[model samples]
Target: MNKLLLGIILGLLAGVVAAIAIPRHHDTASANATATPSGRPAAPHDQVVRLGKPETATQGSATLRPVGAATIEATAHDPHGGPDWAVRVYRGERVLTPRMRQQGTDGVIGHLKCAQLGRIHDGRFGWLDARGTFRPTPPQWGTSSVVCSTPNAAAPLIGTLSPITDPDASAARVRSTIVWGMAGPDARTVRIKVSNISATTQRATPHHAFLMALPARFGQHDVHVGVVYNNGHTASGPANTDRITLVARAPDPNGGLPYGLVTAPSIVPGGAARGETCLFGGGVRVVGDRAGAVDYRRDVLSELEVNGGGGCGSDAQALRKMTCLPGIASGTGDTASEGGDTGGTGRVARRTQRSRTTITMRCAPGVDRVTLQTPRDVRTLVLSPTAHAALAVYDGQFTTGGIRWTAHFQDGHTKSGAVPDVGF
Candidate 1:
């Protein structure tokens, strides 16, 4: 009975061992079944296969491929270094948004949408550089296909030239302010090309205007402007398209004196000339031709009357009264004239004059001071705050020959310009 029991126990142990060994052999076969015949591990079910390295797009170049009715694959490059790029899908110049990303080259852009892409059947792509600048690609028509486009190749349009008075007459130059009426869609910068002139072209970008100064020669000049886009495309106006003719006027032979004074007018004209003089310190004087004598006298009087109630008028009256003397003139023209009298023992002088009228006036608002530099001497005038005219009329005797003027503004800006050819 003991031998039979031991035999039963050994048989059960053998059955358990065989059952485990058979399953282990089948498990090995199952594991091996998953491998290739060469014994290499098989790839994962979710693994992505890479084709190869992508080609870099040139600056301003765009490549687009339609993936679906509303989606597209796109790529672009920056010629000016590796700039992060964005894609803009377009039908003509109209842009659409909601961009997407897909696996592509390092700088390649992908996945843009234009719901009307297939409906329009004609569309284009625009590549935006890292700098937030964009240039459109050429239009692509027809069904799904690879579309490649470049930046706009057309030149920018140049507009009319506006003449600007030369700031410095002594500099012997003229200025022309040009505007870009139609800068092409791709133009990033505008340039003015001035040639066939003796002056060196001076260019400045002030505000949004393009300003240029060229020497004021005696003849005609060839002038044109150009523009350059971010994509390195450039366009210029037709050569010699704009003609600028500068007429040189001879300097005042009389040295800015309209007429010679035989006898100086009274510092203060006592009777009828109450408001004839500019009470604001500078007085009017009549010297040579008197064609506008009555009108000029009337204007001066009107100015004094209108400004008389203001602080400007009070100040002028006070200045004239302080400088005026009885019978004795202190300065030429109306320099010493005023409405009120300076307390003195002598009687006031009265005189009748003709031929020329010289009036000294104040500057316009924003002018702090004005300096007139001439061949003979320099004259400086500190302007009043209330002055509001750009040009100041001075006594006819003030010489304007070879005059260069510098106007200092209240805001610390200075404008220096040549005196008008016609004496001021």
Candidate 2:
């Protein structure tokens, strides 16, 4: 009886051991089946994972949250709902996403970036408004700081002249003030050169203001003001010139004063040498018989209107005398006048004369272009290395009343001169 009982106990113990081992083996197999290829446990299904890095972008009052690396999922919010009411993503100045309207809300979600977003620098999202105005946002993720320094370029120089006060057309004098924009920091010194067809004056100041007492003369009186900055840089202001007209005042019948017009000497014979014309007066003559001449008459009606005729009767007589005088004649060759009737009523018949004039120009060492300006049209000519060219001048009823020349140099410098006569 004792042996049988011992055997029975051993059998029960073996059965219990087998059962425990079998269950342990099955549990190991189940765990192995769920494990990754690298033998690590699989991640949870709803776990949050970051792929690469985070970035931020801010512009105006709006700021964007960090972006996801694998996809473009970001939020942009404005505390004050700035003027830029549209949101978009950008890689520098280039747009990365289509513009979306952000209305009735302070924040917007942008679906912008892609897997390659990591390749961009200072990548950011920005905002725009209906007016096509853009506001940039700071980079949310960048290798360097998102803020960039402002450009240090210089601003253009501009100038304005104060209204003339107490203008005395008879005395040929006027007072005015000229104000120019402040020079940039790069300017070592600021200087201005004021010039007209007849005279030129220069003044330098630490500030940008200049006062002047101008002497009004006849003809198209234009004052050219140019500024010189440091490093030999120069710029010219807009063409703002004053036109002066001198009307002949009739002599006092009672002999109170001499009754004569003060014609500029240069316009008259034996005044200045050839190539010099009376810029202040309306007289131009070319010396030498070879120089052709063209008859040019000033628009008397326009002049009368501008000067408010001293006295209709005397001014009319003066105008008649002016018409009788020979008009501007070009000095190219023989003189011939193509005659035509002035466009006027039969009662006041005026003769129109036309003549051909030849103009020869010699360019400065580096002049690349030359522009000829006449009252009727402007002609521009490109100069070759020879720097010599000739232009034809026609004097007619519909021709440019006056002539001017401008030369543009290779170094970006420009010089201008008034064409005194037909020949240059």
Candidate 3:
């Protein structure tokens, strides 16, 4: 995916070339020209809305029962009754989904923030309804992670289990997160154990889900929440929580942030330069030692609304932030009013758009793939295993909007999110 951050870089690199096309008249038009290529009308913008009558999706009647004795509540919603859905823990009649508001020149504004717990297609499947007063306890454990394929029987079955980052929490200081999950029938309680050399245990039965926040110190692979169930007789089986490990808190300090939540050219290597940009292809090029730097090179061209207008390109040699290249390249913009293009000519300017833009990106850790959903096509980029942290070359475009991405973990789980791109 072309990083949404490319907006800043693309503006710097976009090479402005006045393309003149002489028109030729054709006597015939084919029947296929009259029909839209996709055979469907352009769909309306998809956004969460409140219907007079709410329709919640069961997804095969899937249900989540709180595990342990921690009194958990679950409710699902699908206001439009289709692809988009959000599940919340509230029992109130008012259902709060995502909404968009429009500004005068800023364009339509709407955003849905999600910590995805499951993967579906090219995106995350678990998006819960957001909007509520701050609550710091169970039963009212308003913030949660849920995953369900087919609704399971109320009890004795675990449906969703994933990590949690409290809503609007700061990354600079790691706050205590919930160790919450679903309980199956005969599932009585859950006990969480953290171990490095010695083991300390915490239970979720009598003690509430939200007590005092735990200290923010974590290493790796040293935690598990055991939710054992009583058998119909005596023989019992352990379910998902055994394999699902979680830390009650995240690590705090330099470069401290939740796993997979780091967006960069952050954390400059010792003696390396601060993040900066230059022109690559008629797009901007971000140059950084450790930050997420993306190079936008336009290989394709289309009817652009605005001609290229940017400053000079980068002067630094690759990876050599201190050394200088003899020549620093710069760009020139069109500044004449009596030239070929006029005020009214923009509506039907002669343009050539058969080319493509190739985007090279350096992504942060935990990002398996970067995708750009351009108006023309979707560009998928898979980072090389060893060089993912250093550098990787990929191809994509930096058109207006569409910068969605997915992060893959060692356990084969995926989390999806979007980054906003500036047009530069």
Pairwise TM-score winner, candidates 2 and 3? 3
Top of the candidates by lDDT: 2
Model 1 Cα lDDT, one tens digit per residue, 1-424: 9999999999999999998878654554346433322243322221111222222333233334444232232222222222222222332321222243233423344443221111111143332211122234333332211122233425443333222111111111112212222333455666555564333222222111232322323111245666666688776654333221111111111122121111111124353243322221212112121100101100111111111101123344533433211010122332122211210111232232111222232344566676766544576656434333222332233334555666677788876755444442
- For each candidate, the alpha-carbon lDDT, in order, equals 0.30, 0.31, 0.26
Instruction: Please report how far candidate 3 places residue 419 from its true position, in Å.
Output: 21
lDDT over C-alpha atoms for residue 248 of model 3: 14
- Sorted by TM-score (best first), the order is 3, 2, 1
Model 3: lowest-lDDT 10 consecutive positions: 295-304
**TM-score, candidate number 1:** 0.18
lDDT of 2 by residue, 83-147 (tens): 21111122222222233435555354333221111112124333221112223433443321122
lDDT ranking of the models: 2, 1, 3
Error of 3 at 81 (Å): 42
Tell how far residue 107 is off in model 3, in angstroms. Answer: 36
Per-residue alpha-carbon lDDT of candidate 3 for residues 10-121, written as tens digits (9 for 90 to 100): 7655533212243344343322222212132211111222211221332222222332232223222222232222222222111222232133332212221111121111
Count of backbone clashes, every candidate in sequence: 14, 23, 28
Best by TM-score: 3
